[model samples]
Target: MTLFFLNILLAVIWATLWNSFTLLTLAGGFALGFAALWLARGLLAPHYFRAVPAVLALAGFFIVELVKSCILVARDCIAPRPNIHPAIVRMPLDVRSDAEIFLLANLITLTPGTLTLDVAADRSFLLIHAIYATDEAALVAELKAGMEHRVRKVFGT
Candidate 1:
């Protein structure tokens, strides 16, 4: 946590030194600060170093999935004969913490064709409505492997 704050402080200082506080400047400063922190990883919590990359990876994965889903949705909308096979699937959850479950559910809902309908009271499964769920088992497996896995990685759960 301290390292994260320090990284933000470094970004602010870098912007101040340049007399420019644009978003790009701040982002550049952040990248430089992240590099500096990486160099000093021996002096900090090793978990923090691992977490930063995991979070970035999750973000990257989400972006790719979002784009792919958007394209698929758009194609279906424009098709003469739309082939969407929508279904509500019950996906067994492997992520245990409330925060992890919340993040995973929200990510699934944010994507184009999928919406998280509800989580089981026991938090052991999620009800997901997906536009492309021709095979419920495959859809569940894909989500478990993709978003759920990334969420677990990010939270270290």
Candidate 2:
């Protein structure tokens, strides 16, 4: 949580320095601080800095998927005949730590039409409910290529 605290501190400092304590100013400051920390990775923590880009990629990917999922679900609602093949797919995991797995699960769950039901006891697999799971293999491949892959890449350092 130090990073988050540091971000807040930087925002506050920025407001104090600029003499304008608006939400937009604080947000700009936080973003500036994040950029500063990311650029100064060699002096600070390398792993955290390395994860920033991956985290950003994941965030962008998530936003895109979220929008797509929302549109899909909305189309289903509007259509006279909805054609959704819902299923619970058991997917194997290769992420190293619990935090990685948790983040992956949360990312999946946060997106529409998908829910992370549970994680295997060994942390080797996750049970996910998907609304568009027409084929298990295709869904698994998609997950592997998208969320799972990005999560592993983010924490691989």
Candidate 3:
């Protein structure tokens, strides 16, 4: 009964925030949103205030990385480095949640020259193709240190 009320409350919140009208449309939206929240409630844990600082920190880190990556890509494009080591590295992720892993993969893919090629069958690794890998160890460390750590911090898992 509590879950049902919670679901309805969530639905109402969504509708109120988005300002939807028409009985049919509002009902449909509420049903869909409630169902999604019900299904996803298990995966999304109850982290509240703790996430605020982490989110702010991650946002800052992302902006820095974005700027750095753009500059590097521009430099490489202007002066085609003959020794560019574009390689696919499988980064073993410790993040357990499907949503978190997807977020990380999307972030990597969105970055300048890095592409998220695949996720391993076990969901433990991300296959990423990076254009500027000087050394395997350094590249792996950069991916983990630069982004993965921040992801863990932000998502708290």
- Give me the candidate number with maximum lDDT: 1
| Top-TM-score structure, candidate number | 1
**What is the lDDT, from 0 to 100, of the residue 122 in candidate 1?**
99
Position 110, candidate 3: lDDT: 84
lDDT-superior candidate, 2 or 3:
2
Clashes of each: 0, 0, 0
Q: Model 3, range 90-141, lDDT digits (tens) per residue?
A: 8889887887888889889888989999998889999999988878678888
User: What's model 1's lDDT at 43?
Assistant: 86
Model 2 pairs in collision: none
Alpha carbon lDDT of residue 14, candidate 1?
A: 99
Candidates arranged by TM-score, highest first: 1, 2, 3
For each candidate, what TM-score against the reference? Answer: 0.91, 0.85, 0.68
lDDT of 2 by residue, 1-157 (tens): 4665776899899999999999999999988998888777677766665666788898899899999999999999999999899999999987859899889999999988889999999888999999899998999889889998999878863
Pairs clashing within candidate 1: none
